[model samples]
Target: MNSGFHGNTFAVIIAVENYQFRIKTVDYARNDAIAFQQWLINNLKVPQENIKLWLDVDATKSALNEELQYEISNLTESDRFIFYYAGHGFYDGGYNKITTWDTHPNNIQETTVSLNRILMEPLRNSRCNQCLIFIDACASYIDEQLVSRDFIADMNTKEFSDFVRSSNYRAMFLSCSRGEKSYGSPELGHGIWTHFLIKALNGEAPEAVERERFITSTSLQNYLSKIVPDYIKSSTDIRGTQKPWAEVSSSNTFIIFEVSGASSEGSNNYIDFIFIPERLIIDFENDLIIAYLRGLENDGRHFLMYDYEGLKEIDVEAYCIRISKLKNEIRKILEEIMDFLMEYEWEEEVIFERSDDKFNISAFLYEDDKTREITVSLGLSLKISGLHPMGDTIFDSEFDVANDELKIYTDSSDYNVEEVEIQEIFSDCWDEIRRYFLLEKEIEKELLNEIDE
Candidate 1:
């Protein structure tokens, strides 16, 4: 069922910043949409031709449906589609409508695009199985004191959830809840909510890690769901009001994009790991190494480890598909490692680094119980080259860790794994090390009876 990473992802961006009718100025809504579209290009590697950007004058009711129908009609269940809207959301206490330039509150039913209709008919009926919907403008008229008394009601837009839950494999993220305002600041030059989103897309979210760096619906939701509330509470202009809502018809495990940044040595090469916690990161890297080894062994392929510089670059999506084939094995190895290291101050947090479809690795040392001399564990998550493309449809991801047979032991001194770098409390039992590096201990017992005295 895994389409892997090569699935064709299409998107439609609807940003209505100007209104020909009674809508108030929603400063920077168009800027937010434009920035989001660029993010799709830079991070997700979505083909420019696949994305449709409709802003201001063109985001009418007919245009939105026409775009969705055509795009969804072409896609399959193996592919993905996203719809993002940032502008005025007019709620008549039940029906939620995304307003266009031609939309007037008096003539809303006929003029505005019904979010429910698109999802129900064209989107649900389309060949595409998964839909990601982000609506950034909600209750704008009510929050800004612009709604007329006739439209105001004691009710809320909770019925919108019925439509949201109607579809399977769809995730919906709204800028605010039923009665809340989605804010924008002149300082940010875009909506504050959207500003944080772009930053998070670049791996700046609080949940971001050095190793596992792809942004997902869960990560984005966790980030915005927390930060937006904090910002509203902290700001003087607005407080105790706005709250972003994210709902998935099923578990939202979809990966949106990956982040790239400078390498650890301050070079332009995309870094593999950065700012990962000492214990959690080490185990992640250690397990992945084993995963790579186990996968290679299971596939009956020869394994070799070299500096990341030696690895070849290939297509990211294609590369990920290769990894997914072995991901189940990787997951098993991780579980075993967790059980094996239960005595250590272990946390399961982990991340990986890759770019252009090749992996680069890194891990740094820091003290635990900081005042004490930190125990340098048996493993080092060193940087190494990863899988290289074998052909158009296959890949080679072999790693052995040992360059030569018995070289790690006979020439153990050569490995930079001396006592200065390694610490062991009970010197005799290096059980963890033995299990990790596949070392077999051979102790010779001397016979005293054979001595001639």
Candidate 2:
């Protein structure tokens, strides 16, 4: 026979607003109840159809008593029940009682329901598999005077002991123990323990919980214990104790969710690669570049060079070993590069070429303007390209540095002007050239950093 059963879950919140209670004070309890209900519905993944909530704001003793009886009578074995009562809790010499809206300190019997009668009589005949009961109410100080003698005498009574033993699979979470008073402050709004309990359920107590881990009953109890006392001391002048209790029989654990990993940068063509210590021999068809540093021997001057055209597969192990030999100096070099890259802003532009795969880059720093311009050209090696200024005359030219020969030239005459200021004319052309190469260098640096890091 298959004995397993799954049923609907239900919650009942009674924030008593009787003729005697203050509306402002009762509002806090109602808010707490609603917040907790919503939290369970959202975070616990409990379906709306599977859960039913009953809220009674200002119910008379007769109405409250009838409602409890109806709820207990309607429960089935496949059902899970949660009952939260936030109001006045009083203990007569024989039994613990919860007050209704009409309840008064003097007229105790007509305004209260015996806690034992509420738990045992109707529930004993119902089909509920599990019941969770929360009571946030005032316990009379008068009960304490008679508790020691009366409770002992009651323990000997057959009916009281039988009821305690028979209420299995049921847990009662109380705001205060027997003979203790549960107080709520206007400043704090709700009772201290109730406040933190709601905070924990809403997933905002301390650190967020991981979605994969089950939230255990012990974790909730532990969190409440830590938060309640601290909140009380900070909010009120009275030093009172607020301890919460939980008796969990089910193995179901609570789970939470969190975000992880690095955020993505918006780039269509970017590819990210993890860094590894390898002998990187970059080949540009006609040239081969070999780079290595030995331990702390080299700092900013850590890189080695070779022509790119002469390279085959590199020995990664040998490259790492060589770099490790100069680790300290190489570390400083890398740090400087990282810092420079962090500070340097670069723009990007796409440059096209007909046949050449390699290019030359030249930078010209103007003394007059204190600004730098870069010129990039394909099939050019060891070249100096700059704007020349000579006593109110300016000329732009590209020179072959090895031969000390000017290859391309432009002067004021090219602008269809005679005796025009050379430096002023060339400065205008320098702006376009600067924009082009700055973009290219930025793209190159980005690619290089991705490779290095």
Candidate 3:
């Protein structure tokens, strides 16, 4: 369900920037569409051949109909579909029409594609269970006499929900709500709403982490709700005018895109443990490491921790209490360590390698001749599960702190861990790694100078 190659997923993206009629051009419509198409192929891992893209003059009503009909005929319930439109949208003759490149201003209904007939009806009949729809339109300031109403109010109404709810998994994200224009920013090179959307889909959203950095409907909605409005309000022009809206109807959250390096197979090792507060703990007591697990059938029901050989039954309440107390003490110590670490330029967040009980993190040190970037990757191995500690032998030789309280924390999970003791342990490790990397750099420099001589 992550960013693995999903051949079954398909998309039809249309961006009508220049219309045949005398209509104002939708700014950045084409650029937005292109960005989204790239995201589908790169991030979502949808095949390039599976996507149908129509830009400017290429997006005719007939062409759109043909593509929709083709997918409707071929798609199965196992497959997923995505439809995106970025152009002029208006309401006329009791129906909302999405304007195409060949749409006529006067004869809108006959020339343009009807939103219900051409798009919604095809999706309703299509056998695909999951569908993602994104519409960015109604941005241009056109004469009301010719195009009639720009915004479609019913799109936000209950009837719109009923229409899309026919499919089990459906999410429709609109650029703006009723009476609002989907503003395009020259500064952003995209619609203001689309700007944040692309950013969020690229894994900038806060909710994206828990779901393994996958941008789901719920996550996107929450992100857009806060970010879009904040951007509008904070901007110099067009403040408090445009607000994006999303209607998601599904039993489960529908995943849209996974950020870079976010994949099911790539993150399989530390997926369960990463970001889980309980899993972050290093116990100093008897022997307990809380490991959160989720799988095919055992999803969301089991909170398990493994002992030595097999699943040893223990008091769940007492174990949780012990972990909670340890976590609180560790949290305070971590905050102090964070402050100390902030003085140095770190690469990214701390990454825990579960296979070997190794915590790997890196910091940028210096550049050699402005060509080679030097970074010291610290992999601190802790004693866990009766296994000998590996990685960085100098840590044991240089610092005795690891041999005392830190050593106990790694081996057992039943001791009363003190805050001051953990702080000293981490400080010794950090100081040792920094000194080691610096000494190595100096040695390399000396050797290079000797060779030059």
Cα lDDT of model 2 by residue, 1-453, tens digit: 111124566766676533363222343666656666776577655576544444453456775577777877888887767777776555565776666666654666666777677765676778885666666665423431221111111111123324323554554556643223455656656666577667666666543232222233435544554456456556665443443434332222221211222122331212121112223332323343233322221111211110112223332322211212222222333244334435765332112212111212222211111223322221111111111100111122332222323232222111222223323322233343344445657887999999999
Task: Name the regions of candidate 1 deviating beyond 4 angstroms.
Answer: 1-4, 92-94, 140-168, 208-211, 261-453
Write down the RMSD of candidate 2 (Cα, Å).
32.9
Give the root-mean-square deviation of each candidate in angstroms. 21.3, 32.9, 19.9
Which regions of candidate 3 are displaced past 4 Å? 1-7, 139-159, 207-209, 262-453
* Steric clashes per prediction: 4, 20, 5
Candidate 3 residues 226-307, lDDT tens each?
5775687677355334546566663345557656765545443231221111233445463333333222222221211111
Clashing pairs in 3: 285-413, 285-414, 285-415, 286-413, 286-414
Full ranking by lDDT? 3, 1, 2
The global Cα lDDT (0 to 1) of model 3 is: 0.56
Say which prediction, candidate 2 or candidate 3, comes out ahead on TM-score.
3
Give the lowest summed-lDDT range of ten residues in model 2.
Answer: 383-392
Q: Given candidate 2, what's the lDDT at residue 163?
A: 38
